[model samples]
Target: MGEPLTIHLPDPESAIHLAGPGEENLKLLSKQTGASLVLRGQDLLVSGPEGAVNLCRRLIEALAYLWGQGRSVTSVDILTARHALDTNRTEEFQALQQDVLARTRKGEVIRAKTFRQRQYVQAVRNHDLTFCIGPAGTGKTFLAAVLAVQALQANQYERLILTRPAVEAGERLGFLPGDLQQKVDPYLRPLYDALHELMDPEKIPALMERGVIEVAPLAYMRGRTLSNAFIILDEAQNTTPPQMKMVLTRLGFKSRMVVTGDVTQTDLPEHQASGLSVAQKILHGVEGIAFCQLGRADVVRHPLVQRIVTAYEGHE
Candidate 1:
Protein backbone atom coordinates (compact mmCIF):
# COMPACT_ATOMS: atom_id res chain seq x y z
CA MET A 1 0.00 0.00 0.00
CA GLY A 2 1.02 3.60 -0.61
CA GLU A 3 -0.16 7.15 0.26
CA PRO A 4 -3.10 8.88 -1.43
CA LEU A 5 -2.50 11.59 -4.07
CA THR A 6 -4.69 14.21 -5.75
CA ILE A 7 -4.35 16.13 -9.03
CA HIS A 8 -5.77 19.52 -9.95
CA LEU A 9 -6.63 20.35 -13.54
CA PRO A 10 -6.06 23.74 -15.13
CA ASP A 11 -9.61 25.10 -14.66
CA PRO A 12 -13.33 24.40 -14.46
CA GLU A 13 -13.85 24.71 -18.21
CA SER A 14 -11.42 21.90 -18.91
CA ALA A 15 -12.80 19.95 -15.98
CA ILE A 16 -16.33 20.20 -17.33
CA HIS A 17 -15.20 18.95 -20.73
CA LEU A 18 -13.22 16.06 -19.25
CA ALA A 19 -16.13 14.95 -17.14
CA GLY A 20 -18.37 15.10 -20.19
CA PRO A 21 -16.48 13.94 -23.28
CA GLY A 22 -13.84 11.97 -21.41
CA GLU A 23 -16.06 10.40 -18.75
CA GLU A 24 -15.95 6.89 -20.15
CA ASN A 25 -12.18 6.87 -20.47
CA LEU A 26 -11.87 8.31 -17.00
CA LYS A 27 -14.00 5.52 -15.55
CA LEU A 28 -11.83 2.99 -17.34
CA LEU A 29 -8.73 4.63 -15.86
CA SER A 30 -10.24 4.40 -12.40
CA LYS A 31 -10.74 0.67 -12.88
CA GLN A 32 -7.22 0.14 -14.20
CA THR A 33 -5.58 2.18 -11.45
CA GLY A 34 -7.75 0.77 -8.65
CA ALA A 35 -8.48 4.37 -7.66
CA SER A 36 -11.59 6.28 -6.73
CA LEU A 37 -11.89 9.59 -8.61
CA VAL A 38 -14.15 12.44 -7.64
CA LEU A 39 -14.16 15.75 -9.45
CA ARG A 40 -14.60 18.85 -7.26
CA GLY A 41 -15.08 21.84 -9.49
CA GLN A 42 -11.76 22.20 -11.40
CA ASP A 43 -9.79 19.76 -9.33
CA LEU A 44 -9.65 16.00 -9.99
CA LEU A 45 -9.29 14.17 -6.68
CA VAL A 46 -7.77 10.66 -6.85
CA SER A 47 -7.40 8.53 -3.71
CA GLY A 48 -5.45 5.29 -3.86
CA PRO A 49 -1.99 3.88 -3.34
CA GLU A 50 0.71 6.40 -4.31
CA GLY A 51 1.81 4.41 -7.38
CA ALA A 52 -1.71 3.84 -8.63
CA VAL A 53 -2.61 7.49 -8.00
CA ASN A 54 0.44 8.64 -9.94
CA LEU A 55 -0.47 6.35 -12.85
CA CYS A 56 -4.02 7.71 -12.80
CA ARG A 57 -2.66 11.25 -12.90
CA ARG A 58 -0.50 10.46 -15.91
CA LEU A 59 -3.53 8.88 -17.62
CA ILE A 60 -5.63 11.99 -16.89
CA GLU A 61 -2.88 14.20 -18.26
CA ALA A 62 -2.68 12.14 -21.44
CA LEU A 63 -6.46 12.37 -21.80
CA ALA A 64 -6.35 16.14 -21.23
CA TYR A 65 -3.80 16.43 -24.00
CA LEU A 66 -6.07 14.52 -26.37
CA TRP A 67 -9.14 16.46 -25.32
CA GLY A 68 -7.28 19.74 -25.89
CA GLN A 69 -6.42 18.59 -29.41
CA GLY A 70 -10.16 18.01 -30.08
CA ARG A 71 -9.59 14.27 -30.10
CA SER A 72 -11.98 11.95 -28.34
CA VAL A 73 -10.50 9.62 -25.76
CA THR A 74 -11.18 5.91 -26.30
CA SER A 75 -10.95 2.73 -24.22
CA VAL A 76 -7.95 1.64 -26.29
CA ASP A 77 -6.10 4.81 -25.31
CA ILE A 78 -6.73 4.01 -21.66
CA LEU A 79 -5.56 0.42 -22.15
CA THR A 80 -2.42 1.65 -23.89
CA ALA A 81 -1.69 3.98 -21.00
CA ARG A 82 -2.19 1.14 -18.53
CA HIS A 83 0.25 -0.94 -20.54
CA ALA A 84 2.76 1.90 -20.47
CA LEU A 85 2.46 2.21 -16.69
CA ASP A 86 2.96 -1.52 -16.27
CA THR A 87 5.97 -1.51 -18.58
CA ASN A 88 7.54 1.33 -16.61
CA ARG A 89 7.03 -0.58 -13.37
CA THR A 90 8.79 -3.81 -14.20
CA GLU A 91 10.37 -5.89 -17.00
CA GLU A 92 7.89 -8.67 -16.22
CA PHE A 93 5.03 -6.37 -17.12
CA GLN A 94 6.69 -5.47 -20.44
CA ALA A 95 7.14 -9.15 -21.26
CA LEU A 96 3.49 -9.89 -20.48
CA GLN A 97 2.33 -6.95 -22.60
CA GLN A 98 4.51 -8.08 -25.49
CA ASP A 99 3.09 -11.60 -25.30
CA VAL A 100 -0.54 -10.47 -25.15
CA LEU A 101 -0.03 -7.87 -27.86
CA ALA A 102 1.70 -10.40 -30.07
CA ARG A 103 -1.20 -12.83 -29.74
CA THR A 104 -3.61 -9.95 -30.40
CA ARG A 105 -1.81 -9.04 -33.64
CA LYS A 106 -1.52 -12.37 -35.40
CA GLY A 107 -1.26 -12.68 -39.19
CA GLU A 108 -4.95 -12.41 -39.95
CA VAL A 109 -5.87 -10.58 -36.77
CA ILE A 110 -8.52 -7.89 -37.10
CA ARG A 111 -7.30 -4.88 -35.19
CA ALA A 112 -9.88 -3.30 -32.93
CA LYS A 113 -10.52 0.16 -34.36
CA THR A 114 -13.31 1.07 -31.97
CA PHE A 115 -13.64 1.24 -28.19
CA ARG A 116 -16.19 -1.60 -28.09
CA GLN A 117 -13.95 -3.92 -30.05
CA ARG A 118 -11.04 -3.25 -27.70
CA GLN A 119 -13.29 -3.83 -24.71
CA TYR A 120 -14.58 -7.00 -26.31
CA VAL A 121 -11.03 -8.36 -26.51
CA GLN A 122 -10.32 -7.40 -22.94
CA ALA A 123 -13.53 -9.01 -21.73
CA VAL A 124 -12.78 -12.24 -23.57
CA ARG A 125 -9.30 -12.41 -22.07
CA ASN A 126 -10.53 -11.66 -18.57
CA HIS A 127 -13.59 -13.89 -18.45
CA ASP A 128 -14.37 -17.50 -19.30
CA LEU A 129 -17.64 -16.64 -20.99
CA THR A 130 -18.67 -13.28 -22.50
CA PHE A 131 -21.87 -12.04 -24.04
CA CYS A 132 -21.50 -9.26 -26.62
CA ILE A 133 -24.85 -7.67 -27.27
CA GLY A 134 -25.29 -5.06 -29.95
CA PRO A 135 -26.91 -4.25 -33.24
CA ALA A 136 -25.57 -5.51 -36.54
CA GLY A 137 -22.32 -4.19 -38.03
CA THR A 138 -20.82 -3.82 -34.57
CA GLY A 139 -18.21 -6.54 -35.28
CA LYS A 140 -19.66 -8.80 -32.59
CA THR A 141 -19.47 -11.97 -34.62
CA PHE A 142 -16.38 -11.14 -36.64
CA LEU A 143 -14.27 -10.21 -33.65
CA ALA A 144 -15.36 -13.28 -31.70
CA ALA A 145 -14.50 -15.47 -34.67
CA VAL A 146 -11.08 -13.88 -34.98
CA LEU A 147 -10.38 -14.46 -31.31
CA ALA A 148 -11.39 -18.10 -31.70
CA VAL A 149 -9.07 -18.45 -34.67
CA GLN A 150 -6.21 -16.93 -32.72
CA ALA A 151 -6.83 -19.33 -29.88
CA LEU A 152 -6.75 -22.25 -32.31
CA GLN A 153 -3.57 -21.07 -34.03
CA ALA A 154 -1.79 -20.48 -30.76
CA ASN A 155 -2.75 -23.97 -29.53
CA GLN A 156 -4.68 -22.43 -26.67
CA TYR A 157 -7.68 -24.44 -27.72
CA GLU A 158 -7.83 -27.86 -29.38
CA ARG A 159 -10.63 -26.77 -31.73
CA LEU A 160 -12.90 -23.92 -32.75
CA ILE A 161 -16.66 -24.22 -33.10
CA LEU A 162 -18.86 -21.56 -34.60
CA THR A 163 -22.56 -22.11 -34.16
CA ARG A 164 -25.65 -20.04 -34.77
CA PRO A 165 -29.37 -20.57 -34.76
CA ALA A 166 -30.76 -21.35 -38.22
CA VAL A 167 -33.80 -19.15 -37.80
CA GLU A 168 -35.02 -17.87 -41.10
CA ALA A 169 -34.60 -14.12 -41.43
CA GLY A 170 -37.67 -13.80 -43.66
CA GLU A 171 -36.28 -16.32 -46.13
CA ARG A 172 -37.42 -19.90 -46.47
CA LEU A 173 -34.33 -22.04 -46.35
CA GLY A 174 -36.27 -25.21 -47.19
CA PHE A 175 -37.40 -23.76 -50.54
CA LEU A 176 -33.99 -22.67 -51.83
CA PRO A 177 -31.35 -25.27 -51.17
CA GLY A 178 -29.47 -28.42 -52.29
CA ASP A 179 -28.58 -30.07 -48.98
CA LEU A 180 -28.26 -28.96 -45.35
CA GLN A 181 -24.87 -27.32 -45.84
CA GLN A 182 -26.04 -25.53 -48.96
CA LYS A 183 -29.25 -24.59 -47.18
CA VAL A 184 -27.50 -23.08 -44.16
CA ASP A 185 -24.55 -21.67 -46.10
CA PRO A 186 -26.24 -18.30 -46.45
CA TYR A 187 -26.73 -18.00 -42.70
CA LEU A 188 -23.12 -19.00 -42.12
CA ARG A 189 -21.55 -16.93 -44.91
CA PRO A 190 -20.55 -14.18 -42.52
CA LEU A 191 -18.63 -16.75 -40.48
CA TYR A 192 -17.00 -18.04 -43.65
CA ASP A 193 -16.05 -14.57 -44.74
CA ALA A 194 -14.35 -14.03 -41.39
CA LEU A 195 -12.44 -17.28 -41.82
CA HIS A 196 -11.36 -16.36 -45.35
CA GLU A 197 -10.04 -13.06 -44.10
CA LEU A 198 -8.05 -14.78 -41.35
CA MET A 199 -6.82 -17.84 -43.18
CA ASP A 200 -5.88 -19.03 -46.65
CA PRO A 201 -9.02 -19.89 -48.60
CA GLU A 202 -7.60 -23.12 -49.98
CA LYS A 203 -6.34 -24.24 -46.59
CA ILE A 204 -9.68 -23.69 -44.93
CA PRO A 205 -11.23 -26.75 -46.53
CA ALA A 206 -8.38 -28.94 -45.30
CA LEU A 207 -8.71 -27.51 -41.81
CA MET A 208 -12.44 -28.12 -41.82
CA GLU A 209 -11.91 -31.65 -43.05
CA ARG A 210 -9.50 -32.29 -40.24
CA GLY A 211 -12.09 -31.02 -37.74
CA VAL A 212 -9.72 -28.38 -36.41
CA ILE A 213 -12.45 -25.87 -37.22
CA GLU A 214 -16.16 -26.64 -37.25
CA VAL A 215 -19.00 -24.36 -38.31
CA ALA A 216 -22.42 -25.82 -37.92
CA PRO A 217 -26.01 -24.99 -37.13
CA LEU A 218 -26.99 -24.65 -33.47
CA ALA A 219 -29.26 -27.69 -33.75
CA TYR A 220 -26.20 -29.89 -34.30
CA MET A 221 -24.84 -29.04 -30.87
CA ARG A 222 -27.77 -30.34 -28.81
CA GLY A 223 -26.33 -33.39 -27.12
CA ARG A 224 -22.53 -33.21 -27.24
CA THR A 225 -20.25 -31.69 -24.64
CA LEU A 226 -17.52 -29.40 -25.91
CA SER A 227 -14.12 -29.50 -24.20
CA ASN A 228 -10.82 -27.81 -24.92
CA ALA A 229 -12.51 -25.72 -27.59
CA PHE A 230 -13.19 -22.10 -28.40
CA ILE A 231 -16.92 -21.87 -29.06
CA ILE A 232 -18.84 -18.95 -30.49
CA LEU A 233 -22.59 -18.85 -30.66
CA ASP A 234 -23.59 -16.02 -33.00
CA GLU A 235 -27.15 -14.88 -33.63
CA ALA A 236 -27.88 -16.11 -30.15
CA GLN A 237 -30.89 -13.85 -29.82
CA ASN A 238 -32.82 -16.35 -31.90
CA THR A 239 -32.13 -19.19 -29.48
CA THR A 240 -34.84 -20.26 -27.10
CA PRO A 241 -34.23 -20.44 -23.34
CA PRO A 242 -34.03 -24.21 -23.55
CA GLN A 243 -31.53 -23.98 -26.36
CA MET A 244 -29.35 -21.46 -24.55
CA LYS A 245 -29.29 -23.62 -21.44
CA MET A 246 -28.39 -26.66 -23.46
CA VAL A 247 -25.57 -24.85 -25.24
CA LEU A 248 -24.14 -23.39 -22.07
CA THR A 249 -24.24 -26.65 -20.18
CA ARG A 250 -22.29 -28.34 -22.93
CA LEU A 251 -19.12 -26.52 -21.96
CA GLY A 252 -16.60 -29.02 -20.56
CA PHE A 253 -13.12 -28.63 -19.14
CA LYS A 254 -10.85 -25.93 -20.56
CA SER A 255 -13.48 -24.50 -22.90
CA ARG A 256 -14.37 -20.85 -23.50
CA MET A 257 -17.56 -19.59 -25.04
CA VAL A 258 -18.72 -16.27 -26.46
CA VAL A 259 -22.35 -15.68 -27.25
CA THR A 260 -23.21 -12.67 -29.44
CA GLY A 261 -26.50 -11.31 -30.62
CA ASP A 262 -28.65 -8.28 -31.41
CA VAL A 263 -31.88 -8.10 -29.46
CA THR A 264 -33.37 -5.73 -32.00
CA GLN A 265 -32.77 -8.24 -34.77
CA THR A 266 -34.47 -11.27 -33.19
CA ASP A 267 -36.04 -13.50 -35.84
CA LEU A 268 -37.91 -15.87 -33.53
CA PRO A 269 -41.27 -14.29 -34.37
CA GLU A 270 -43.11 -11.81 -32.15
CA HIS A 271 -44.43 -14.32 -29.64
CA GLN A 272 -41.19 -16.01 -28.67
CA ALA A 273 -38.82 -14.55 -26.10
CA SER A 274 -35.20 -13.91 -27.01
CA GLY A 275 -32.74 -16.18 -25.18
CA LEU A 276 -30.15 -13.42 -25.16
CA SER A 277 -32.47 -11.05 -23.32
CA VAL A 278 -33.25 -13.76 -20.80
CA ALA A 279 -29.62 -14.79 -20.38
CA GLN A 280 -28.60 -11.23 -19.60
CA LYS A 281 -30.90 -11.21 -16.62
CA ILE A 282 -30.15 -14.74 -15.45
CA LEU A 283 -26.39 -14.43 -15.66
CA HIS A 284 -25.94 -11.11 -13.96
CA GLY A 285 -23.40 -11.15 -11.07
CA VAL A 286 -22.23 -14.66 -11.95
CA GLU A 287 -18.51 -14.93 -11.40
CA GLY A 288 -16.08 -15.76 -14.24
CA ILE A 289 -18.52 -14.44 -16.83
CA ALA A 290 -18.47 -11.10 -18.64
CA PHE A 291 -21.04 -9.00 -20.46
CA CYS A 292 -20.50 -6.10 -22.85
CA GLN A 293 -23.31 -3.92 -24.07
CA LEU A 294 -22.36 -2.26 -27.34
CA GLY A 295 -24.18 0.72 -28.84
CA ARG A 296 -24.48 2.27 -32.31
CA ALA A 297 -21.27 4.18 -31.62
CA ASP A 298 -19.48 0.83 -31.60
CA VAL A 299 -20.37 0.07 -35.23
CA VAL A 300 -17.22 -0.05 -37.32
CA ARG A 301 -18.79 -0.25 -40.76
CA HIS A 302 -19.47 2.61 -43.14
CA PRO A 303 -19.86 5.91 -41.28
CA LEU A 304 -23.41 6.10 -42.58
CA VAL A 305 -24.23 2.76 -40.99
CA GLN A 306 -23.68 4.16 -37.55
CA ARG A 307 -25.89 7.11 -38.36
CA ILE A 308 -28.57 4.82 -39.70
CA VAL A 309 -28.51 2.69 -36.58
CA THR A 310 -28.66 5.80 -34.44
CA ALA A 311 -31.56 7.09 -36.47
CA TYR A 312 -33.52 3.90 -36.03
CA GLU A 313 -32.71 3.76 -32.31
CA GLY A 314 -33.74 7.39 -31.89
CA HIS A 315 -37.04 6.75 -33.62
CA GLU A 316 -37.73 3.82 -31.33
Candidate 2:
Protein backbone atom coordinates (compact mmCIF):
# COMPACT_ATOMS: atom_id res chain seq x y z
CA MET A 1 0.00 0.00 0.00
CA GLY A 2 3.03 2.29 0.64
CA GLU A 3 6.65 2.59 -0.32
CA PRO A 4 9.10 0.10 1.18
CA LEU A 5 12.50 1.17 2.50
CA THR A 6 15.77 -0.56 3.34
CA ILE A 7 17.61 0.95 6.29
CA HIS A 8 21.14 -0.29 6.77
CA LEU A 9 22.53 -0.45 10.28
CA PRO A 10 25.88 1.23 10.83
CA ASP A 11 27.10 -1.62 13.01
CA PRO A 12 25.50 -4.54 11.23
CA GLU A 13 26.78 -7.00 13.80
CA SER A 14 24.36 -5.47 16.28
CA ALA A 15 21.37 -6.51 14.21
CA ILE A 16 20.89 -9.68 16.19
CA HIS A 17 21.07 -7.77 19.44
CA LEU A 18 18.60 -5.18 18.20
CA ALA A 19 16.27 -7.80 16.83
CA GLY A 20 16.45 -9.82 20.09
CA PRO A 21 16.46 -13.57 20.36
CA GLY A 22 14.36 -15.36 17.72
CA GLU A 23 13.71 -11.95 16.16
CA GLU A 24 11.51 -11.02 19.15
CA ASN A 25 12.50 -7.38 19.06
CA LEU A 26 11.54 -7.26 15.40
CA LYS A 27 8.23 -8.84 16.32
CA LEU A 28 7.69 -6.19 19.00
CA LEU A 29 8.71 -3.45 16.56
CA SER A 30 6.22 -4.81 14.01
CA LYS A 31 3.50 -4.88 16.66
CA GLN A 32 4.26 -1.29 17.59
CA THR A 33 4.67 0.08 14.05
CA GLY A 34 2.45 -2.30 12.06
CA ALA A 35 5.34 -2.70 9.64
CA SER A 36 6.68 -5.88 8.17
CA LEU A 37 10.37 -6.26 9.01
CA VAL A 38 12.77 -8.34 6.94
CA LEU A 39 16.39 -8.75 7.89
CA ARG A 40 18.70 -8.97 4.89
CA GLY A 41 22.46 -8.82 5.37
CA GLN A 42 23.20 -5.52 7.18
CA ASP A 43 19.96 -3.81 6.12
CA LEU A 44 16.43 -4.19 7.43
CA LEU A 45 13.59 -3.87 4.94
CA VAL A 46 10.49 -2.13 6.17
CA SER A 47 7.30 -2.80 4.22
CA GLY A 48 4.05 -1.13 5.26
CA PRO A 49 2.03 2.03 4.80
CA GLU A 50 4.31 5.04 4.53
CA GLY A 51 3.58 6.45 8.01
CA ALA A 52 4.10 3.10 9.69
CA VAL A 53 7.34 2.57 7.79
CA ASN A 54 8.59 5.99 8.85
CA LEU A 55 7.76 5.28 12.49
CA CYS A 56 9.45 1.93 12.20
CA ARG A 57 12.58 3.64 10.90
CA ARG A 58 12.60 5.97 13.87
CA LEU A 59 12.19 3.04 16.26
CA ILE A 60 15.03 1.18 14.64
CA GLU A 61 17.21 4.25 15.05
CA ALA A 62 16.22 4.49 18.70
CA LEU A 63 16.99 0.87 19.21
CA ALA A 64 20.28 1.46 17.44
CA TYR A 65 20.99 4.32 19.82
CA LEU A 66 20.60 2.11 22.88
CA TRP A 67 22.51 -0.75 21.33
CA GLY A 68 25.23 1.68 20.36
CA GLN A 69 25.33 2.72 23.99
CA GLY A 70 25.93 -0.93 24.86
CA ARG A 71 22.60 -1.48 26.57
CA SER A 72 20.56 -4.61 26.09
CA VAL A 73 17.21 -4.26 24.37
CA THR A 74 14.23 -5.80 26.13
CA SER A 75 10.47 -5.68 25.52
CA VAL A 76 10.19 -3.03 28.23
CA ASP A 77 12.87 -1.09 26.40
CA ILE A 78 10.72 -1.27 23.26
CA LEU A 79 7.74 0.06 25.20
CA THR A 80 9.86 2.88 26.67
CA ALA A 81 11.11 3.65 23.18
CA ARG A 82 7.54 4.02 21.91
CA HIS A 83 6.59 6.18 24.88
CA ALA A 84 9.63 8.37 24.26
CA LEU A 85 8.66 9.01 20.65
CA ASP A 86 4.97 9.61 21.37
CA THR A 87 5.73 12.08 24.17
CA ASN A 88 8.71 13.83 22.48
CA ARG A 89 10.98 12.55 25.26
CA THR A 90 13.57 10.96 23.00
CA GLU A 91 16.27 13.40 24.09
CA GLU A 92 15.42 12.97 27.75
CA PHE A 93 15.60 9.23 27.26
CA GLN A 94 19.10 9.67 25.87
CA ALA A 95 20.12 11.54 29.01
CA LEU A 96 18.80 8.67 31.14
CA GLN A 97 21.35 6.41 29.49
CA GLN A 98 24.17 7.86 31.56
CA ASP A 99 22.42 7.40 34.95
CA VAL A 100 23.41 3.85 35.81
CA LEU A 101 22.58 3.23 39.48
CA ALA A 102 24.04 -0.20 40.10
CA ARG A 103 24.48 -3.65 38.62
CA THR A 104 22.86 -6.94 39.55
CA ARG A 105 24.55 -10.25 40.30
CA LYS A 106 24.80 -11.02 36.58
CA GLY A 107 26.19 -7.55 35.77
CA GLU A 108 22.85 -6.25 34.42
CA VAL A 109 22.46 -2.49 34.71
CA ILE A 110 19.96 -1.45 37.44
CA ARG A 111 19.05 2.02 36.26
CA ALA A 112 15.58 3.49 36.24
CA LYS A 113 13.39 1.68 33.73
CA THR A 114 10.81 4.47 33.33
CA PHE A 115 10.52 8.22 33.63
CA ARG A 116 8.74 8.07 36.98
CA GLN A 117 11.39 5.72 38.29
CA ARG A 118 14.07 8.16 37.21
CA GLN A 119 12.36 10.80 39.32
CA TYR A 120 12.42 8.44 42.30
CA VAL A 121 16.14 7.83 41.79
CA GLN A 122 16.79 11.57 41.65
CA ALA A 123 14.79 12.08 44.85
CA VAL A 124 16.77 9.38 46.64
CA ARG A 125 20.04 10.96 45.59
CA ASN A 126 19.10 14.56 46.47
CA HIS A 127 17.21 14.16 49.72
CA ASP A 128 18.50 13.03 53.11
CA LEU A 129 15.13 11.43 53.79
CA THR A 130 12.96 9.89 51.06
CA PHE A 131 9.65 8.02 51.11
CA CYS A 132 8.50 5.97 48.13
CA ILE A 133 5.01 4.47 48.35
CA GLY A 134 3.85 2.17 45.59
CA PRO A 135 2.27 -1.15 44.79
CA ALA A 136 4.31 -4.35 44.85
CA GLY A 137 6.75 -5.04 42.02
CA THR A 138 7.29 -1.29 41.57
CA GLY A 139 11.00 -1.53 42.50
CA LYS A 140 10.49 0.70 45.55
CA THR A 141 12.45 -1.54 47.90
CA PHE A 142 14.78 -2.90 45.24
CA LEU A 143 15.92 0.52 43.99
CA ALA A 144 16.45 1.79 47.52
CA ALA A 145 18.51 -1.27 48.30
CA VAL A 146 20.56 -0.81 45.15
CA LEU A 147 21.31 2.81 46.00
CA ALA A 148 22.01 1.93 49.64
CA VAL A 149 24.63 -0.61 48.65
CA GLN A 150 26.07 1.76 46.07
CA ALA A 151 26.49 4.47 48.68
CA LEU A 152 27.99 2.03 51.15
CA GLN A 153 30.36 0.64 48.51
CA ALA A 154 31.38 4.14 47.45
CA ASN A 155 32.12 4.97 51.12
CA GLN A 156 29.54 7.74 51.09
CA TYR A 157 28.12 5.98 54.13
CA GLU A 158 29.95 3.91 56.73
CA ARG A 159 27.20 1.30 57.03
CA LEU A 160 23.94 0.00 55.55
CA ILE A 161 20.91 -0.53 57.83
CA LEU A 162 17.74 -2.26 56.65
CA THR A 163 14.57 -2.76 58.71
CA ARG A 164 10.91 -3.60 58.21
CA PRO A 165 8.00 -3.92 60.60
CA ALA A 166 6.93 -7.48 61.47
CA VAL A 167 3.20 -6.89 61.15
CA GLU A 168 2.04 -10.41 60.36
CA ALA A 169 3.63 -11.76 63.50
CA GLY A 170 2.51 -8.87 65.66
CA GLU A 171 2.30 -10.45 69.15
CA ARG A 172 3.76 -13.77 68.04
CA LEU A 173 7.27 -12.39 67.50
CA GLY A 174 8.58 -14.32 70.49
CA PHE A 175 6.64 -17.50 69.65
CA LEU A 176 8.68 -18.24 66.52
CA PRO A 177 12.03 -20.03 66.06
CA GLY A 178 15.31 -20.00 68.01
CA ASP A 179 16.42 -16.67 69.54
CA LEU A 180 15.36 -13.18 68.39
CA GLN A 181 17.37 -13.20 65.16
CA GLN A 182 15.98 -16.51 63.97
CA LYS A 183 12.46 -15.49 64.93
CA VAL A 184 12.64 -12.38 62.73
CA ASP A 185 14.74 -13.85 59.94
CA PRO A 186 11.75 -14.88 57.84
CA TYR A 187 10.21 -11.42 58.07
CA LEU A 188 13.41 -9.76 56.85
CA ARG A 189 14.14 -12.23 54.06
CA PRO A 190 13.24 -9.69 51.39
CA LEU A 191 15.98 -7.36 52.62
CA TYR A 192 18.44 -10.24 52.55
CA ASP A 193 17.41 -11.08 49.02
CA ALA A 194 18.02 -7.48 47.96
CA LEU A 195 21.42 -7.41 49.66
CA HIS A 196 22.44 -10.67 47.95
CA GLU A 197 21.41 -9.18 44.63
CA LEU A 198 23.43 -5.94 44.98
CA MET A 199 26.35 -7.10 47.15
CA ASP A 200 28.57 -10.12 46.91
CA PRO A 201 26.92 -13.17 48.51
CA GLU A 202 30.11 -14.54 50.01
CA LYS A 203 31.13 -11.13 51.34
CA ILE A 204 27.80 -10.44 53.04
CA PRO A 205 28.47 -12.77 56.01
CA ALA A 206 31.74 -11.01 56.84
CA LEU A 207 30.20 -7.58 56.31
CA MET A 208 27.23 -8.38 58.53
CA GLU A 209 29.56 -9.84 61.14
CA ARG A 210 31.49 -6.57 61.10
CA GLY A 211 28.23 -4.53 61.28
CA VAL A 212 28.86 -2.93 57.87
CA ILE A 213 25.52 -4.30 56.62
CA GLU A 214 22.88 -4.67 59.34
CA VAL A 215 19.48 -6.23 58.61
CA ALA A 216 17.30 -6.28 61.69
CA PRO A 217 13.69 -5.95 62.77
CA LEU A 218 12.28 -2.48 63.32
CA ALA A 219 12.08 -3.23 67.04
CA TYR A 220 15.86 -3.40 67.19
CA MET A 221 16.14 0.24 66.12
CA ARG A 222 14.67 1.84 69.24
CA GLY A 223 16.91 4.21 71.26
CA ARG A 224 19.77 3.84 68.75
CA THR A 225 21.45 6.71 66.95
CA LEU A 226 22.21 5.52 63.42
CA SER A 227 24.87 7.87 62.05
CA ASN A 228 26.86 7.93 58.85
CA ALA A 229 24.62 5.20 57.44
CA PHE A 230 22.35 4.44 54.55
CA ILE A 231 19.12 3.17 56.14
CA ILE A 232 16.11 1.70 54.35
CA LEU A 233 12.78 1.04 56.05
CA ASP A 234 10.77 -1.35 53.91
CA GLU A 235 7.11 -2.28 54.53
CA ALA A 236 6.57 0.94 56.36
CA GLN A 237 2.81 0.68 56.10
CA ASN A 238 2.79 -1.90 58.89
CA THR A 239 4.39 0.51 61.31
CA THR A 240 2.50 2.68 63.81
CA PRO A 241 2.97 6.46 64.09
CA PRO A 242 5.00 6.15 67.31
CA GLN A 243 7.32 3.57 65.76
CA MET A 244 7.85 5.71 62.67
CA LYS A 245 8.56 8.76 64.84
CA MET A 246 11.05 6.87 66.95
CA VAL A 247 12.94 5.44 63.98
CA LEU A 248 12.96 8.73 62.11
CA THR A 249 14.33 10.49 65.20
CA ARG A 250 17.20 8.00 65.27
CA LEU A 251 18.61 9.43 62.02
CA GLY A 252 22.01 10.86 62.98
CA PHE A 253 24.46 13.15 61.19
CA LYS A 254 25.75 12.39 57.67
CA SER A 255 23.11 9.73 57.06
CA ARG A 256 20.45 9.06 54.44
CA MET A 257 17.14 7.21 54.90
CA VAL A 258 14.71 5.79 52.40
CA VAL A 259 11.32 4.47 53.55
CA THR A 260 9.30 2.41 51.05
CA GLY A 261 5.93 0.70 51.30
CA ASP A 262 2.41 0.20 49.94
CA VAL A 263 -0.28 1.74 52.15
CA THR A 264 -2.92 -0.29 50.38
CA GLN A 265 -1.42 -3.50 51.75
CA THR A 266 -1.32 -2.36 55.35
CA ASP A 267 -2.23 -5.22 57.71
CA LEU A 268 -3.14 -2.99 60.64
CA PRO A 269 -6.42 -3.26 62.48
CA GLU A 270 -9.46 -1.24 61.37
CA HIS A 271 -9.09 1.42 64.11
CA GLN A 272 -5.30 1.73 63.72
CA ALA A 273 -3.56 4.25 61.48
CA SER A 274 -0.68 3.40 59.15
CA GLY A 275 2.59 5.07 60.09
CA LEU A 276 3.52 5.63 56.48
CA SER A 277 0.15 7.27 55.92
CA VAL A 278 0.73 9.57 58.86
CA ALA A 279 4.30 10.24 57.81
CA GLN A 280 3.10 11.13 54.31
CA LYS A 281 0.87 13.79 55.76
CA ILE A 282 3.27 15.09 58.42
CA LEU A 283 6.69 14.94 56.73
CA HIS A 284 5.61 15.95 53.22
CA GLY A 285 6.62 19.64 53.17
CA VAL A 286 9.58 19.22 55.50
CA GLU A 287 12.89 20.33 54.01
CA GLY A 288 15.53 17.73 53.11
CA ILE A 289 12.75 15.16 52.67
CA ALA A 290 11.09 13.78 49.53
CA PHE A 291 8.07 11.59 48.86
CA CYS A 292 7.63 9.81 45.53
CA GLN A 293 4.47 7.92 44.63
CA LEU A 294 4.38 5.30 41.88
CA GLY A 295 1.35 3.53 40.47
CA ARG A 296 0.45 0.43 38.46
CA ALA A 297 2.07 1.93 35.38
CA ASP A 298 5.41 1.78 37.18
CA VAL A 299 5.22 -1.92 37.98
CA VAL A 300 8.24 -3.47 36.21
CA ARG A 301 7.54 -7.08 37.03
CA HIS A 302 5.94 -9.66 34.74
CA PRO A 303 3.25 -8.35 32.35
CA LEU A 304 0.57 -10.26 34.24
CA VAL A 305 1.69 -8.66 37.50
CA GLN A 306 1.00 -5.24 36.02
CA ARG A 307 -2.39 -6.40 34.82
CA ILE A 308 -3.20 -7.86 38.22
CA VAL A 309 -2.28 -4.62 39.98
CA THR A 310 -4.39 -2.63 37.52
CA ALA A 311 -7.35 -4.96 38.05
CA TYR A 312 -7.14 -4.73 41.82
CA GLU A 313 -6.83 -0.95 41.67
CA GLY A 314 -9.87 -0.70 39.43
CA HIS A 315 -11.95 -3.01 41.56
CA GLU A 316 -11.16 -0.96 44.63
Predicted model with the maximum TM-score: 2
Off by over 4 Å in 1: 1-109, 169-175
Q: Candidate 2 on 136-222: residue-level lDDT in tens?
A: 988999999998988888899999999999888983787787987789889999999988888779999899899999998898899
Backbone clashes, candidate 1: 0
TM-score of each predicted structure versus truth = 0.67, 0.91
RMSD of each: 10.5, 2.2
What are the Cα lDDT values of the candidates? 0.77, 0.88
Residue-level lDDT tens digits of model 1 in 85-163? 5556334322322333222223422455444567788899777799999998888988888788888989999999999
